[model samples]
Target: MVRTVLVLGGTAEARRLAEALAEAGDRLRVVTSLAGRVSRPHLPPGEVRIGGFDGVEGLTAWLREERVDAVVDATHPFAARVTASAAAATSALGLPFLVLRRPGWRQAEEDDWRWVGSVAEAAELLPTVGTRALLTVGRQELEPFTRLSDVWLLARSIEQPNVPIEAVLGRGPFAVESELELLDDHDIDVLVTKDSGGDDAKLVAARRRNIPVVIVRRPPSPAVMIVSTVDQAAIWVIYGHATVS
Candidate 1:
């Protein structure tokens, strides 16, 4: 019997896991769901569905309607609401659930680091720390920095932002050499990033230069089995299906 899997994906790991599952066999059907926020999203493997599912109740209804055998959440680490909704929906439906979360970034010896719990905290620290800054965090939270008119922000995002601050439009999966160049070009004295750690080379480069990084902590996830990689998630999916078979 064929099994269907619903993957709540927006991260690199989600795309990788969906591809792996597709290559595994014909017995399993994979559908990857993406939040329609990114302007031109890199397409993932298998079937792709874009946009939100209303909320937890909506997600639960969709899961049942689609007959999803399992769920793998690969959202951004700071995506607290969707993750919580997915967990609640899966639990209510009595469906198998797994989380594919990339590990958080760690502080290095060469780094000048100040950890903060949220974006607001990081924004508050910018005045005391540096005047010229690079806000590596996404465009959505750019509003908080508006209050800090004294600080010069070189903000990077996929598209041009309408925020009051100076913005640069670009994409990432950035190389360390390029990141270093960007740091120099922007005259960035301080960096702000979230702890969603699928990529590390850039962070490592920042650390090597002794640039202060104010890392926003990841929100706590619901109680569920967590795996660090796409391969690990694929293994869990196959194993869970085997048991059901």
Candidate 2:
């Protein structure tokens, strides 16, 4: 028997899960749904849909209409809204669902990490750390730092911010040497970032330079069955559909 699965895709893990499901054979018709935040997202294999399903009601209607057998919420860790909505919609229909989460970074003994709740809180804490800062919180939410005239900003993202910033356009998996050079070149003293896990390039570089890092904690995701790997999610999808049917 054939099955159709909906994967809420945005993060790298989401794309990986989509690929794994696609390779599992034609028995599983995988559909990947992107949030369309990025102008050009890395398209996943199989059927792809973009944008929101409005809300929980809209999503439930869509699932029923499409005859989705199961769902995998593989959104970004920070995407609390989408995760919560997925949980609600799936629970309403009693559909099989799971969260595919990539683990966050843990602070090492040598790490000079100052944890904050949000970007605004990070901005408030920055003055205590350094006057020159590297902000890796992305271009969308640069509002908190705009008012800080004393502290110089080095904003790094895939796209540029609307507000004037000392910008560096680059992607991550950043080298320690490159990070060191960037810090040295700009005389950067503090690093600001979201707790976007599965990477440690900036954390290590900051530690080596004795740079204080102000990290914004991720918003609370809906409490649900969470798995860390694509294989784990795939197994859930396979077995879940069987159980549901």
Candidate 3:
């Protein structure tokens, strides 16, 4: 017997987990859903679905109609709303749900880290830290830094920012050497990023340089089974499928 699985994926782990499920063979039919935010998102292995589903209600409806057996919340760490909605939707429908969050960056002995709860808090801390700033918090919240005209910003994102604030467009998993060069080129004095853990190469580079980073906290989710790696998720899914079969 085969089971259908829906993976809410936007991170590397999602892609990996999807591929793992595909490798597990005909016992599972996997579909990975993307947010359709990135202009050119890296294609995940197997069947792909893009765009939003209104909200939790719509998602619950889809799950029931599609007869999806399990759901994996493998979105970016800062992607709070979607993850929360997934938790709620899965719970209301009594579907097994797992959250796959990559580990957060660890601070070294020489690193200077200032933990903040949100992007606004990080923006407010800019005045005291440095005159020149590098905001890597994504394009969506660029508006917060626009009000701080006194500080020169070197903002980088895949898409161009809506509001004005020195923006750079590029893709990452940037190399450490390249990121260091970017910091030096922009004369960056302070770094602002969400505690969006994972293999975000640029954030790792900043940490290595002992740069002061203001990390935005991750939003809380409803109590559910959580796994940190794709491999773990695959095993769990296989075990569940076996039990049901």
Model 3 CA lDDT for position 234:
88
Stronger candidate by lDDT (2 vs 3)? 2
Error at 40, model 3, angstroms: 1.2
Q: Candidate 3's residue-wise lDDT over 35-151, tens digit each?
A: 998879998888898999889999999999989999888888788889888989999999888887887777667678888888898889888888888888999898888889788
Residue lDDT tens for model 2, 71-174: 99998788888888899999998888888888888988988889899888998889888999999998887888998989999999877788888799886668
At residue 149, candidate 3 shows an lDDT of 71
Tens-digit per-residue lDDT, 23-123, candidate 1:
87988899999998887898888899999999998999999999999998988888889899999999999988888888887676777888898899999
lDDT for each candidate structure:
0.85, 0.87, 0.84
Q: Residue 148: error of model 1 in Å?
A: 0.6
Query: Candidate 2: lDDT of 14?
Result: 83
Which residues of candidate 1, in runs, are more than 4 Å off? 241-245
Winner by lDDT: 2
Error of 1 at 20 (Å): 0.1
Residue 211, model 1, lDDT: 78
Stretches > 4 Å off in candidate 3: 207-210, 241-245
The deviation in Å at residue 182 for candidate 1 is 0.7
